[model samples]
Target: MSRFMSAALCALFVFSMTTANASAADAPGKAVYDINCSTCHKDGVMNAPKLGDKAAWAPRIKQGIAVLTKNSITGFKGKVGMMMAKGGHPNLTDAQVKSAVEYIVLQSK
Candidate 1:
């Protein structure tokens, strides 16, 4: 192949790889969890579910992701503890909250 053509292909390959890696690492849900969820979930603050805690998450998971997302967005007061709407982050859009919920569920299960 021509030198210029080879260089162009290499550049394209690099660009595509970089984009894919970035997207995979910074998935919407993971990003939201890093910012909004790590605080409570990481430490189980105020009884928040810990990441990868399948036993703790079993009942909630049975309730389904949709309900879990709703509770995360609208706020849930459970016997263990209460979660404020959007984890008390008013700036969070419903989509963001849902993403966080999905991320947590994915990790737990």
Candidate 2:
């Protein structure tokens, strides 16, 4: 192949890989959220923050992701319900819990 063509293909491949990697980070978060968080969060069961509810999430978001992540991982009791640590799945790693929190927070906002 021509040198120019080969370079173009390499660049394209690099760009595609970079994009995929960036999105991959979110995929696990979304997956974890779907399996663990969405059950209550999507429907507001027991007053859990409903997914995509800007008003419900606004104050929590203001407290910042750190506090939210901590609450989610360590468990928190609020007016309506209690969030079990790791959403009651102790098997989940801290990273997974954090990812799920990230997914939920971004979606709610």
Candidate 3:
């Protein structure tokens, strides 16, 4: 193969790898979000707040990440609705819940 052709192939491979890694890194909590949070958050079921509703999340975001993480971990009872502890998945650790919360917050914002 010509040197030019080899260099082009190498650049393409590097670009594809970088794109994949960037996409993966962008969603740090995607796994936890998918497994635990998607059910309610996807459709705003029981007022759970849809994944990208800045209006719905604005107030909660104002409350700050620590509070959001705590609510996600310990469960929350708000005027509109409630969230179960660990998203009703008792097996989920605090870190998992927090990761999911961070993902949700990131998307919402």
- Compared with the true structure, what per-residue lDDT tens digits does model 1 show for residues 1-109? 6999999999999999998679657776887788887899998999988999999999999999899988888899997999998988989899878888888888898
TM-score computed on alpha carbons, candidate 2? 0.74
Give candidate 1 regions above 4 Å deviation.
1-25
Top-scoring candidate (TM-score):
1
Better of 1 and 2 by lDDT: 1
Model 1 worst lDDT run, 10 consecutive residues: 19-28
Better of 1 and 3 by TM-score: 1
Candidate 3 lDDT tens digits, 1-105: 699999999999999999868865877588789988899999989988899999999999999989999988889999889999988998988887888888888
Q: Name the weakest run of 10 consecutive residues (lDDT summed) in model 3.
A: 19-28
**2 versus 3: better lDDT goes to:** 3
- The candidates, ranked best first by TM-score, are 1, 3, 2
lDDT of 2 by residue, 12-96 (tens): 9999998867866658688778888888888888789898999989998999988988998899998778988887888888898
RMSD of each: 6.1, 6.8, 6.8
TM-scores of the models, in the order given: 0.76, 0.74, 0.75
Candidate 3, residue 13: lDDT:
99
